[model samples]
Target: MTRLVVIGNGMVGARFVEDVLSADTAGRYDVTVIGSEGCEPYNRVLLSEVVAGKHDFSALTLPTPDSPRLTVLRGTHAVRLDREDRHVETADAARVRYDRLVLATGSDARVPGLTGLRNREGLTSGVHALRTIDDAREIVAATLNARRAVVLGAGVLGMEAACGLARRGVAVTVVHPAAALMERQLDEDASRVVESAMTGLGIDQRVGRGAVEALVAHGRLTGLLLDDGEVVPAELLVLATGTVPSTALAADAGLAVDRGVVVGDDLSSPTDHRVAALGDCAQPPEGGSGLVAQGWEQSRRLAARLCSPALSATFASGSAKAVPDRDPTSNVSDVVRLKAHGLDVVTMGVCGSQRTDDPAQRTLHLSDPDLGRHVEVVVSGGLLVGATCVGAGPVAAELVTTYTRRTPVPSDPAHLLISALTPQPRGATGSVADLPDDATVCRCNGVSKAAIVSCVHDGAATVDQVAAGTRATTGCGGCVDDVCALLAAVSTPAPGEPTDSPTTSRPREDDVTKGKHMIHSAETAGS
Candidate 1:
């Protein structure tokens, strides 16, 4: 049997393995995945949801119950890639030989080039990056009592961070080089919506400003010095400088590099025939695609090529399936944010204001700051290219779907966004959220609703419990709210669940008292 070794078992690598097993494309592959993360494959797309208390971090999970042929080696990594020899060395110096290798070494937070961040104890604790699950947890725990936080970036991640900290009662001040939030995706009209939402959340937005350095005093972050000589004070500093492809090993191992690993349509590196890459580490066609779903698409197609004997390297673009829909659970965490205690802001597609100077795509936007509304849409040749929205009722999910799926723009033009902005009729059946169990939950983590349902039965009640129980909300935290909603669905009582039988007793532990009859054991399952 030919051996396929996958490195950096994060979202992308894990996705590749899953596609290999599930897809109908006929192939025979001996797969061995070496992941640095100790847990199962989970998402890293919505980490902000975790901070907002949307769901349990454990809900993000990818499984292989049906495929016993696959071997996933967790908490391990490909320390070195010998593309020529078709093998990789683990951090423990274990040499794993393979017929083919994969480089899914994802990116990490890019620390800014600055000064004065170092403290007297030479402590870098004050400097933080919101990249991994550990990173979000530390940021959350460290900012438990933080009075103020300085976020350096105007991108989607930065904006989300600003709102997330603010929701936790931390005074958040966003400092971005761009003049607006989500400048990459939304137009100026759409940016106004985000701006107003930020203001409502008590987030101080300072756009078109760059952080020159992180000022520190006595090993504590005092404030940040802007390029324009402005001093913004904060007790905590979050560096959302965005991520760069973590291709040091691949680059060091002599792989071709562009903005990321230059992979062909088949996800194999141009120079190394034995080596393949995906996710944040592998640059998809059209130069780059950071979305985890797209990476999974690549993984699916590649898995067919490697795992099945009927498929060969003569693959073409049309052979791959359409870009999968955004995970339904992606918004569940946010829904929890709205019903529960979280900042109610929504953004999709490109985050920042688009520039005429930039090439490709036309822009259309609507702004209503008085009502705290902003909507922006990007169009190219009558197709929804990109968009972003902020505020309570904007149709962000729809825009994201239409844009991502390359769905044709409606004839009315404004119908694409305006219809989304228009409130859905009560009892609306079709919605991005009106999904079934078979729907993928976390595109980043490859979790499903059925797996999450199993987790609910496993004693994971709260969102945090679910994250710990299933690893769902652990990654991007995007699906944190979705998982929470799912939990609510499972935990809440229906009209018929309770027997309504009279009882006489006192309060008991576990939220089920003697007289209350608060819960039904097996009866609730069907209910």
Candidate 2:
């Protein structure tokens, strides 16, 4: 049996293991998964929920360890990769041999270089960044004792972290170098709406200022010093500045490194075809695709190559194309990318590559400032090129799909966001009758409508239960609202029967701890 040694048991790595184990391949590989975290993989994207007190430790799990061929080593770090010897050394000096290697060493949040920030015990805490499940646990623990929190970035993470603390009744403030928040994913008009929504939730948004130094009184963080000579006081400081690829291990091994560990299209390291990298550490042809979807895809490609080497990849096989190139078939299989903030925002296929200034290019811009809503639909050459939405509704994903499929702009493109505004959208992606027999109702793992309906008929109540039964609405969660609707159609007892809540279908302890991607995608307004 071939042995596969996978490192960094985070989302992408854990996903690779699940895929390989579940696949009906020619031969099973002996899997050795090395995890730096003390526990099995959990959803890091939902760190905000942990901070918000919606879930303590109960709601975070990536996948399970059940395969007989799998040997999981938690709290062990891979100290070195020896390609010549076909072995890897854990930090404790245990060596494991492998026919193939997968590096899913996902990134860590970039802790900014701040001066004198400290914790309550009168010790310098420095900068705070959240990128792992353990990091979330620590931040949640710290927030309990913190009365005020200052986040030093207005990106999605900063906003989520800031808002989560605010939701828990902590005084929260966000500082951004840009004038607006989420500037990379949002435009001026849409950003205004998002800012309004956040401010309405009681988050202090600060811009055009940098923390010159952190104020530590005798060892604990008391406040931050501004470049403008202003002292802003807060009990805790979180630096959501950004992230860099976690590549120290790969770099030590002398693998090709750019923004990340440079790998070919098939995710094979340039130095050794026997070695492959997946997840945040491996920079695929797209060159360090920061999106989890891209990382998951790389894992899929590497798994296929390792388990079923004869099959050719759909995309360019050997020399990889840059991730920036728009491939119409990027959705050959379903992919779930989790970047959870309060907003249901999605960026796909070359964001901001739009002809905004051209009068000839058809564009529809709609905004209701009172509701903090803005939707921009730009159609050029009959392809839904780009869109931006920040508001009281769920239009970002709906618009992203239109742009992804190059869907024909309706006679009234304005209806794209409004058409699906049913109190609870059901069978609206396409008509139940017109949907091809293969169209997925639960797009997480490409479970078709027939599969879901069959499960509902087979005994599933409430959307959450159906999610466990069908694995639908468990990918990007864009479909959970629809799954809930399907549950409404499922046969149910008449009145007086207790309904499903967090009690009946709380998911098996194992499922909550490890089964599949529960974080899914960003929250659908209804989920």
Candidate 3:
């Protein structure tokens, strides 16, 4: 059997291992997974939720089954990589040989070098970075007696962390350099709605300012000193600035490294075909978003290439003459949903307002500051190109579904912001039942309406069962509501309750290969 060695056993790495093993059912390869963390691979995206008491630490770990032929090494760090010998040396003084190698090293939370934030003993108490389970635990510990907390960076992580702290009755203030929260995902109007929502959540915000120093008193964090000479008193300071791809091991191994480990459309090293890189650690030629969905798609594509030679050949043949060579899976829509509770925000495709004179690339917007709701839609070539919905209730989910499925917008742009609770006028596009079977329900897992229906037909009734069977809503948890709605529609009703049939029974081609990719393409609008 061929020996396959995978390093950095995070979520993407673990998923790739499962996909390869499932495809190679004949035991064609002996797989080994090496994880840097001491325990099994866990979901890093839900760390904020864990800190907020929504889930325990144990809930973050993926419940993967054990394979007799597969070997998993926890707390083992790969120290050296000898490409010529095709082996890796771990810190535990073991040399592991491999016929193929996959790197899922992932990325690290970008921490700035602020004075008083660090000492000879490392980060001082009350100062933390929320990136891992350990980081979440430490923050929780510090919040035990913490009353006032200041979070630096108003990005997704910072805002989420701030909200989590606020939920715990900790007075939280977010300091960011951006004029608006989630500047990359939301436009000005959408951000305003988010700001209002934050206000309702009892969270304070400081925009256009950055924390220059971690204020310390006798080696304990007392507050943060901003660039504008403003001192925000706090017992805790959490830094959620951003992230940088972890490429040290790849670079030390003499592999090509730029913003990340340089790889092709197939996620293979340009110089070494035997080695592959995926997740946040890889920088594809066409570039990549630092989103978990992109990494999940790459994992699926790479798994197909490794488990079946015929599939790889087909992909190679199609891309042989393509300009600016890219992965076929890379051209899917990427939807990002903020996981903060009570914050209804979903942003997909090209967001922000369009400026071009072309009548086709028109942008429709609705901003209700009083209602704390904002919705923006950009249309190009008469199709929905991009959308952003903030504090818009159920309409956010509808907009996400429409954007992901590439569905047509109503002739009236005003209908885009209409509440889902509001009755749809006659001649409307109908409901979720109207969605095509091929319409992706779970973009993170690529589970379509047809796939979910098939699972329902096979005795998988609950959303949890469908998730276990098809792995939908497992990635970002953004599509759980849609999955539940579909389950109710397809499952047999109790007794004489009527079952609503699908509005459209048309069967479009199901590209099950690109699950998350099927939902989100990497195209951002007004970039």
Candidate 4:
């Protein structure tokens, strides 16, 4: 049997193993996964929820069910790769042989260029980075004694850490170099709404400035010295600056390394056909968004390629094959959503301030600072190309679905938001039933309405069962309502069924289905 050795047991690596095992059920390959973390793969996306006291460590861990064909080596770090011998040297001095190697090495949190970050030993006290589950736990423990805490960076991780700490009654302040929060994703208008909403949540924000130094006095962190000569008092500092792709192993092995490990259209290393890369560590020739959904797509596609009969024959013949363009997840939604309570933010596609010269481009902006609501839309060719929604309530989900499905908009785009806040008029342009089956319901997993319907037909009668079977509403949990809507639309209830249960009957405006319950389940699934 061909041996497949996978480095890094992150979400991407674990998922690739799952896809491989599911496809190669005949046990054609002996698979071994080398994980740096000691525990089973857990969802890193929900790490903020863990710090918020919403989920325990074990709750976030993914399943690694026993299989005769698979072996998982937890807490094993690959230190060196010998491509000639097709073996990897682990930190523990053990060597793992492989016919094929997959580098899903993921990424590492980037710490700011600050002084006194460490002594002879690594990572001084009162300083932490929220990258791993262990890091979240450390931050959570620090919050217990931290009356005042400062999170450096106004990006997603920083905002998430700030919100999580504030939720636990810790006085939190976020310092970012960018003028607006999540500036890369949200426009200035949407950022202002989110900033105001977060301020009300007991989190202070300082923008357009960054920390100059991590101040350490007598073996303990006092606070951070800002670039503007202002010192922020804090007992704890959580650095959510950003992450850099972990590409050392690939680079050392003589593989092409750019911003990340360079891979072809097939997710295989350009210099080595026996090797492949995925997740944050990989930069595919067609490009990548560094999103989990994209990583999942790479994992799934790579698995299919490795298990294909053509691949087996080509491998035996030592023949070269052209990398076909079969990546479907690339078209997945670029929506950046926050799952925090009382903060509903979704930023997708282009929300930039600069107006495009293209006549086909249409931009709409709405901002109500008092109500803390912001909405921006960029339409090209009569379809939404970009959108940002802040505190738009359930209308945010509706807008996302409309955008994802490429449904025709009303003559007035503002009507989209209006219909969401209040009851729709007698005649509305779009409804859930009108959505195409091919339209992606779960953007993170690339799950379409037809897939959910097929799952329902395959004994996935309930929402949770559908999630388990098809991975709908799994990532980001933003599409839970969509999944529920599709479930109610497709599922047929038994005779004398309650109105609350799944039914073939179309969803009425007044009928309260199991949508909220399913959404809650989806939101808290990995929590």
On TM-score, the leading prediction is 3
Can you write out model 4's per-residue Cα lDDT over 213-323, one digit (the tens) per residue?
888889888888888999898889988888999999999999999999999877888899999999899998767676787788777677767777666454334332311
After superposition on all C-alphas, the RMSD of every candidate to the true structure, in Å, is: 8.2, 6.1, 6.4, 5.2
Model 3 regions more than 4 Å off: 317-333, 352-360, 410-422, 425-434, 494-527
Q: Give the TM-score of candidate 2.
A: 0.82
TM-score for all models, in order of appearance: 0.74, 0.82, 0.87, 0.87
lDDT of 3 by residue, 390-496 (tens): 77646766766666555677776556665453876887875555677766666656666787778777776555667788887566655555665666565536456
TM-score of 1: 0.74
The candidate, 3 or 4, that scores higher on lDDT is 4
Q: Give the runs in model 2 whose Cα sits over 4 Å from its true position.
A: 117-123, 313-361, 392-401, 411-451, 454-478, 490-527
lDDT of 3: 0.74
Candidate 1 off by > 4 Å: 22-28, 64-71, 118-123, 309-317, 321-364, 377-386, 392-394, 397-527
Which has the greatest lDDT? 4
What C-alpha lDDT does candidate 4 achieve relative to the native structure?
Answer: 0.76
In every candidate, how many clashes are there? 45, 4, 8, 0
| Model 1 lDDT, residue 129, Cα | 80
The alpha-carbon deviation from the true structure for residue 189 of candidate 4, after best TM-score superposition, in angstroms, is: 2.3
Across 198-283, the per-residue lDDT of candidate 1 in tens digits comes to 77768888877788888777667888899899999888888888889988888888989888988877778888778888877877
